[model samples]
Target: MAADGLDEIDYGILHLLQQNARSTTPVDMAEQLPVTDTTIRNRIDRLEEEGVIEGYVPIVNYEKAGFPIRLQFSCTAPTKKRHQVAGQALELPHVVKVDEMLSARENVQVLAVAKTTEEVNEITAGLDDLPLTIERESLLREERRRPFGHFGQHVVDD
Candidate 1:
């Protein structure tokens, strides 16, 4: 949470934007917030500049958008080979994020942002070929979104 002038009203504005940034005009917000349009605009500007607000993004349902599969895999790789495996994983198709875990004992949970079920299977196959053990796997059949659930927003390039 940002401490700079971030009060309840600021949070409210953020909530509104999360659902849709262009939902309310400054004039519309002024009527409800008891603040001027300039105030709202200036605050938004400051939020963007301070890196509190990132960018507007259209929420797309992964399934509807042809990304019919979501897979989470936990596996283990050597500490020395962590960098090498991580680098290669990033280039694999349908991979979204690979995170290193300190408490994993000897495993890492990777949220593969795959485009399809086939892609997910292929990625898993490739990873399986290595000396890594797959601990857990999950298929994301839906794209979940809250009404206004953005704590922070940044540019998401599709």
Candidate 2:
């Protein structure tokens, strides 16, 4: 095993997959790492089976997909009911993401997308009905993500 119980090949696979899962194939990873395509395939399967890879999902452009209004809701949930409140918030139709924070003041954060201000108002109303207190709500301009750098570059035999 490599650092953090994952082998170097695993890290390489994770790095490449994070960079571009759609374009990065086992063969591509093999050419970069000191392993065969079969090895890469098997490793990916194992990683998924072990619940590390989780799931492969497309990063959709909500605005382009007819949801131009993006909003973030910051809320304070009762400490003991944070998880429950988050789950309830996530169940709301426009809600796309819910995060439970460590801070008690603003513990629940919800990301929602809508096609119109009416829909945005509806989402806000739904959240307000929940067991949490809405602290702040703001429009989301954009979001960017990238592979974790600690996953590192391609592994080479030293």
For each candidate in turn, give its C-alpha RMSD to the true structure in angstroms.
Answer: 6.6, 2.0
TM-score against truth, every candidate: 0.63, 0.93
lDDT by residue (37-150, candidate 1, tens digit) is 899899788879978799877765666767666787877777777667766666666767787766534456676666655776798887787656777787766545576555
In model 1, what is the error at residue 4, expressed in angstroms? 5.4
TM-score of 2: 0.93
Model 2: residue 56 alpha-carbon error in angstroms: 0.8
- Compared with the true structure, the alpha-carbon lDDT of candidate 1 equals 0.68
lDDT of 1 at 131: 56
Question: Which candidate's TM-score is highest?
Answer: 2
Each candidate: how many clashes?
A: 1, 0
Which residue segments of model 1 deviate by more than 4 Å?
1-5, 75-91, 97-109, 113-117, 125-134, 147-158
